[model samples]
Target: MKGRRITMPEPVHENPPEFLRNAAEPVRDHLLGAAPLPAFLHGADQLSLEDRRLLVDQALVLLEQNYVHLPLKTAMHAVNPVQRLRLLRRRMERQTPQTMPREWLFHAEMSEIFHSVRDLHTNYLLPDPFNDKIAFLPFLVESCTEGDRTRFLVTHVASGFSAPGFEPGVEITHWSGIPILDAVDLNAARFAGSNTAARRSRGVQSLTVRPLVIHLPPLEEWVTVSYIDLAGTARELRQSWQIVENLPSFVSADRDTAVSQGLDLDGDETQRAKVLLFAPRVVAQERAAEADESLPDLGAGEIATSMPKVFRARAVTTPSGTFGHIRIFTFNVSSPGTFVAEFVRLIRQLPQGGLIVDVRDNGGGHIHAAEFTLQTLTPRRIAPEPVQFVNTPLNLRICRRFQGGPGLDLGPWVPSMEQAVETGSVYSGAFPISPENGANAIGQQYFGPVVLITNARCYSATDIFAAGFQDHGIGPVLGTDENTGAGGANVWTHDLLSEFLADDPGTPYTPLPKGAGMRVSIRRTLRVGPNSGTPVEDLGVVPDELHRMTRRDLLEGNTDLLDHAGRLLQGLPPHAVTITEAAPADGALHLKLAAENVDRVDVYLDQRPRASVDLTGGQADLMVQGAASAHTAHLEGFEVGRLVASMTRDLS
Candidate 1:
């Protein structure tokens, strides 16, 4: 290999080409065969647009069929020469490599990427696989182009300076002895791909607004971490970024665990394992564990992570039996076993009547939370929808363990499954819910009935939980339209493909219109309900019953959904009540309450307890001295306190 300082010119737009932005000479040579590597890309400033095209034309010819993917190779011949040339031209127009040409990216489409194994461009790097990601850090920090006019918002760990004058969250104008924008922009330029997964990475759950990750490499004096801005816009700057707001830390962690697609299998995709961009899950995990040794506890242990007390176990007396009540705000800390343990305990303490699971504001967390809950609450085995990767060469290679080899039993792939694979555009089969998933579940099933409640806030994994309940007709769902649960199922992104846009040794990489490497839903989630084969990602989980929260419900904390659920579980009629002949004068309140199966009326004016009036024969005159205000009356005596028939009226 020719030794050269692989530097770029100033375009003052003078940046390393996208491929070189990620990879460098070594990777280029490995993929390009004996074709002479470009002499000096830094001199591109003097080259005219046509001159640049000539250079690209030559490179294209040299790479004609040498390193092309199987699908692309076939297409290259199938298409006419004019179309082929046009295709190549479009690639050049989109990919602005400061100097070198892209081998696997920019020009490469997502569909094209799937049917092809990554050449040396995105895969082969750093001599050591374990430390490959660690070696990639310097490119992100140091390789930005000097004098390029670009702006970036950089954040740091502590409230200290990341550079001498460059503080976190401040606009970095210069970096590493150069005007920083170009570097940030040049570095940022690589991630310009148009991937939908990246666009939809909003509402992602993290322990806090900013999730801090610090990595210390072995035998190295320096330590590195990924703070923010994998894409040009930092997450905080993005339009759809969300944090674990108003959620307990455990709940956030649980959802984070689920969203990151953490699995319970004996692998590194656990709560603590930190994987780097594009590295194989197995290797990145080992290095993360190794690097974790040097990290300070950083208050992780100091913070108590006990389960949040979300269950309100009260069994109200019903004609047949008692009805149980439980409210869930989120599945943040709802780990499969962790949540199941609490579920088992709460259900054990409840009366023999059916249960009401109030999931109003709960967005979801891990699927395992639902899985374990299913295992503990029901006797049926839970089966996850088949999650298959796209039919790309890299995916085919990665999924080979399931495709072939000694672990063939693990994969459900075979000749008979051809129709399913072809129809689904997927190469693998669904995953059977493993026993390890329900390790925390109680063996017995709950014979009592269940009632589910939801709203728009009942989203994501909560959608999964609701679907699971519907799968078994476990209960009636309330507080949502016919569209039912959140129409999103579990999604797995391709950070592997995403690595093409990351900062690496030879080339700093990214797709066009940069920023966004988050996961996409490769396999739509298949619901286990009667509508088998129908994905919840589209129609969502249909509800057995429907109800919605009114504006007053949101403002006044109405439990009408809960109330409706209780009545449904108890086979009782809807208790209707009305307030009329109302008058508020001289700080005195008087109202005629016409009701049925009523016991008494508890009135609260301006949220303060005011007075109570005992009812007789479902009628009472409520006269109480109070201020002129909006009053709420709880018209009760339906069954237990569980059944509260209430009404709201303004006494002005």
Candidate 2:
């Protein structure tokens, strides 16, 4: 799909896939049905007052026993979820059976208590109807700065749906009867956001799309939106909320794969929803590409890659320099190795002078993918962030129960937690989730100056990735907001939790009365390097530079944002270290290498230091004995005794 360029008054592009007309017809009808909810939603068995009390009690157990950030949330927010849940149960007991509230109301009350924690990783997933649906509008609204004021603009409108004069770039002044920005703030107060930036960003995003699994559907069936047309004329239109199926698949982590995980389930689901609404052509292309291993037809400068959903790369030409720009939409991939390998391949194909990585709305996926990707950008040995469990007897038993299981092995945490009984430690000893060797296995693949772009919507694994970048001294981080979403924990679904504790009858965990479920932060993450031991929750990684989104940035393919990143890249020094040739000859190693801004090269054979070669005129040739029999060769480039680049080559 060719991306549209900025034009004066016309909408960005009108070429939506024709297939959407037929595809969206039934969905729209279902949304406009007479009933407030679908028939399937009404079929659920009503829960008694006791059933509601049991559900609250069950969720409270996880919070008190397994939640890693309970103390932090309590200390920071001054809200006690456990106390609140207990009170909810007491209130349920006092009510007569005939006066029992509806099951959805009970679920909403429980969700409120969890949302008070301000942790997206922890949530109360509603039952049946709500879990499998999403509430969305036809278009998305985003805010951009104009001098000292912030303006709300219609960024994207779904295909097969149209609001005359309500196209992209039109300004939205009011929502229903309230001011647009005021409505966003009011909505932001209902969700879980650890910081102000995150709250506002999420509020803006939820204005168009909301996954019902983690959030209730919109209460109002229709909204009258007031906006200014391209001619600066005031206009008003009423649009109804649409209910559509939201079935996003999650790949679980095992010992052999991901070390730790931080995922935003709602964000993951809504990402697909955004594509389905705003870019249906891309969705159709994704299906066709996956079926036949074909490449999607991308716009000008956009790289054609197999993993189109996870990565979007283009060779951008800016005023500073023509460099590579890759936008990582999400980290929700199944294979971390393939994720990193493909990333390395993409960078090698782009102009090597500089690169910009944009992860603005990335709600993190696998921890391994985020941590391991860091080593490819810098020469420093990667230290994966450590994770620790809240010290408690239940956590100790849970660790022992799944020690050698295929899924989670809390065994490593058991020792410290057991020792905590006598030492009175509040948390288990921290341990790295991804192994250090695995992270550095590929070594540095890109040696050019690089800059990362982030926003408040960047959460979970993305937070870890940004943290590692800053901690390891990779490059400059440019953020659209002051900080990330501040979600830094490994989240596990209630289904997985039930499976782990199913065989143990002594456990209080049982299947919910309905299809209701919950997710909790099982392990909290800690930063490494200079910021060692600092928790990533609540206090997320602060960027080195901040750039507010501009009018051109929203309407012109991030023109201003990329310009800012390009300027940052131009100021930084670029380095290149390449081993052009390496081979065994006459019981010795023959190597030809090229270096830029490097004075010396260090060689390690099978991880043991073998030789140090001085560079002359940015080139070197060396012959060393015993290296011919080594299984691996490691190279490090240094300028003025500071290591700037590294590479690893297999000799076996």
Candidate 3:
């Protein structure tokens, strides 16, 4: 933590606010056995002219053949990355002076070509030092709205750092002598985002902490910040950037299977960086929880759960009602079963009035994890978002070769791709990234009214989760932003790409220089139901209602935002359908089922209609044939023929 302090003012209080105290806690500087903050980074220029050509040529091959969103990106941005790369290659070939420039310039050129597409799924990963490091200031800043105006506030100040009066809730007016908003816009332009709102939001977020994998370090060694303190006193501070090595690794399984190879490459690194910057205390708590399995429950309505890193559950009482609130930090977990099971246990602990599932700032991971979690909230069949690949000869080759291979089954897509050669279709037929039956297998776990809260930082698998929530008519979606990050493609690493770039003669395959790597969007996702066949890229999931972040939301514990969502929940009807017991008796299934706010119960065995019974008392014993062999039993509770509450159980 090295910096130049230019000003120091009196503290606003003898003790700082709790939010300030929580924000001031330092992150584990030695994350993943990495080094402490370094005063300066090691410098080197190792990229040769030949290395540059290899990188560019490989990038071109991916953009032309493996990238599924190329057609969409070309149409949306009106840019041809293929042509741009060809021109760059030509210039490199014609140069008389063979001397190589700085490595960043070459990396920047390659990055810029992909950035033009505005897709985070596709990127040019810098090698070694740059790849392993993250740059950060020891604080976090967020925004809130005052009527028509938006204000930036210093929401956090890292521990051991001295900022005097510039504590949490201090209004930031300027950055590096430029107006704060203008500076954010300037920084936003350098990053990749699918829309203007996403770019600007990410811009504000990246102002303090940037993962060097996707962004270059700030040119200025330090930044000058000007702001107004809590007492309306003006102040200035200079904060220097600190470098940390070995960002946290988030290697997850494929659909919770043991097949882990070729799957760990899809882990979300940017999400880990955000977790380090925004919620270090929570991260610290998670680490502590992991270290000690018998860690006591977090009081203040916090629920005890197995997955503390992915889920933070609490029973929140709002003006509308007492509801179960779960802040889903990220979907970057290995087992979807454990994730959803923990979710089910948490919701069951709270009052069934309603549930507010918050996925704000949740950079998504694992397609199956996100899609499989959707069935827990709704009675309707969960139709997982369909995925498509660009119709290319090389893609066909990879699909044909890797069909039924380990952790990489391109089988379902092969047939459609084979037919595309004659149909002249630009993309293969759409297929769900997750199995449809797996999505609907668990059925509805939460019967109360539900609402999902989202923001612009919601991306990839998070984007899919939001879309599935809306597409399935589960409940209203309340958003702090107009749309999600709109990253609709399944990203594949250069290692996966190499599987397609085989070792045959005359193959356009070469080892990436040094530790350099690339990731391309191999499959584009499409929406289901009403928006079926529509791409989820660029056009992200729009919220049913929008709530601006109030000052209370930033300074307090999202008090107003929860209140808004609670009121929305109040309007929707609530239902209760609990199955207390189930067993096979004689030749039929018997059960103790409880129903509230419903008059009828329709039973289905393995998705086949079995029997319909009237709900007279609150509880009843249910019986149907073939229960011994049936794998699942779905009970739909309805009032006057209108479905309200649904429950599913495993019969075997």
Candidate 4:
């Protein structure tokens, strides 16, 4: 069997393309890793036009690879043709410091190529269902290049398409290709003039005025490309010098034209008008709202208004004085500063008796806010102890300076007083405690029993406040069974990767150009109780007293815990006094007690007996002195109840 002889196709043109002339040799040299290729091949006199051209083609291939690999839309957008070319050159030449060489012509050409390819692929190859026919025509028109020879391809493709209500002259428009005219400048004409007018008109106006349609290249018709291909192509083109140099100029020109024509590019006519006419009024309104004093400054009022239905807090005061008066301050988890100051003020104003601070639904805020509140409430000042050095390092040694006098010239060894330094400690000296200057201006003279009411809703800075109070002996936490634990303390930075360019449906790539975000912990706070030494890193502060309530108590509107607290404050025993007879008849429970010196007697069943009780007037007949002038009690069946007796003194 004879092998077929391969025939190599001859070059169509005797002279290579300009880019090929400038790029080929440099690209070949870079591939060979001979001498380092110039950062910019276009400017180097050593590289021929062919070398630069070859380099560009090679750079385009590398750019295509990068575009294919782009995972995020933002990165794809960033790697425009110009950038792609620069990156390719850098990679090939192993340029240090990774600096992109500036090239204006390459960037311009690449930008145009990127947009054209992207538009074609998005509209022609992958036409979205949501796209309108009008937009489709414009997209095709915008994608055409000046050098394209097969101009009839676009017209042929669009000929069969029919859009209802689109007419040839009144509504529809057309454009013809012309050198030096950008897509934006290619003015669309209404319709072709009659045959008589075609012969009559001549020069630029003839083509400009007549309905002219630029043909799409036949090569473009065969271009069956995907989004990835278009995106890569665009990125490569954007890396070129031509596109990058004109970006700022293009943006500025567009802006200037828009402003001059009074065009609202954002299309928000009403908003734009409002901004233009009443900007000062809007600013004034904002300022006035900010300065509002009647508004709830730092806590629930702000949060409730901002986040209406999510969470809310209302300051509750009891109508009856039985439970005394307690101010329930609720704050949002975001803004603890306002609440901290308010809390500090409240603690300072507390009388020398007893105080019940409620933090039932405080979600949390800044750690500093909580710490500051604690500092204000703390009665004792705990300063950082100075560290002593036995043998200091030579680098840390201090030099002594002394002033010499006539008689004291002999005494040259004057040792300087060493200031004490701080060593390892949980709390830093950022905000130190001082007796005169550092003390809370409101003062912390309250020497009273402090109680804090907390629930599961209490979290973050609120938990910190509770912990600080408990740790510093500022207060005793009362209830905290249903509170949310501290979480989401560390702040995270967002890494945005892509630019949203247009409202079109079929734009190919969306990139997250950057890497992973940074996580930061703003500050460290201390927890309450015996574990004060342990930092509240991931754990929340635990409540000192865990009080659980039953549904029955809630339904009955009975605050048993509050009542118990009241009892404690009033110096009353917890259990009721009781007395029961060992023997009983008629299934009735009765208790009786007598004392010569006592005025009243109270009795409790299934509990301890008390001598103090008040009975109106009916209980006197049931009592009589029997054995040793002591009041006797009637016997009854065992039952759980309290009985009280009141007596008057016999003055006779």
Kindly list the per-residue Cα lDDT of model 3 for residues 502-601, writing each as its tens digit.
6656556578987888878888889989888888888889999999998899988999999999999999888767778878888887777889887888
lDDT-wise, the better of 2 and 4 is: 2
Name the candidate, 1 or 3, with the larger TM-score value.
3
TM-score of every candidate = 0.41, 0.92, 0.89, 0.28
Angstrom error of the Cα, residue 492, model 4: value is 5.7
| Ranking of all candidate structures by their TM-score, best first | 2, 3, 1, 4
Candidate that scores best on TM-score:
2
Against the true structure, whose lDDT is highest?
2
lDDT of each: 0.39, 0.82, 0.77, 0.28
**How do the residues 364-413 of candidate 4 rate in per-residue lDDT, one tens digit apiece?**
43333344444444434322111111212210121121124431121121
Candidate 4: residue 650 lDDT (0-100)? 15
Worst 10 residues of 1 by lDDT: 238-247
Candidate 2, 1-652: lDDT as tens digits: 2122111122111332232333453133222321223333445546777777778888988899989999999999999999999888789878988888876677778889999999999999877756767777778999999989889999987756666698889999999989999999998999998899999988888998988888876767778999999998999988766566653453544533333668877778788677656765555455555666556567888777767667888899999999999888888877789889889888888888999988988999888888899998998999999999999898898888868666556678889999999999999989877778889888888889999999998899999999999999999999999999999898876667777678887877878866778889998999998999999998888999999999899999999999999999998888878778889988998888899999999988888998999899999999988677878888899999999988888877
Expressed as tens digits, the lDDT of each residue in 418-527 for candidate 1 is 55445764334554322333533343334455777765434545666777777755557775445433334443333332342244443222331211222333333456
Once all C-alphas are superposed, what RMSD does model 3 give against the true structure?
A: 6.2
- Candidate 4 at 231: error in angstroms? 67
lDDT of 2: 0.82
User: Candidate 3: lDDT over CA atoms?
Assistant: 0.77
Report the poorest 10 consecutive residues by lDDT, candidate 2. Answer: 4-13
- The residue ranges of model 2 lying beyond 4 angstroms of the native Cα positions read 1-50, 250-259, 404-407
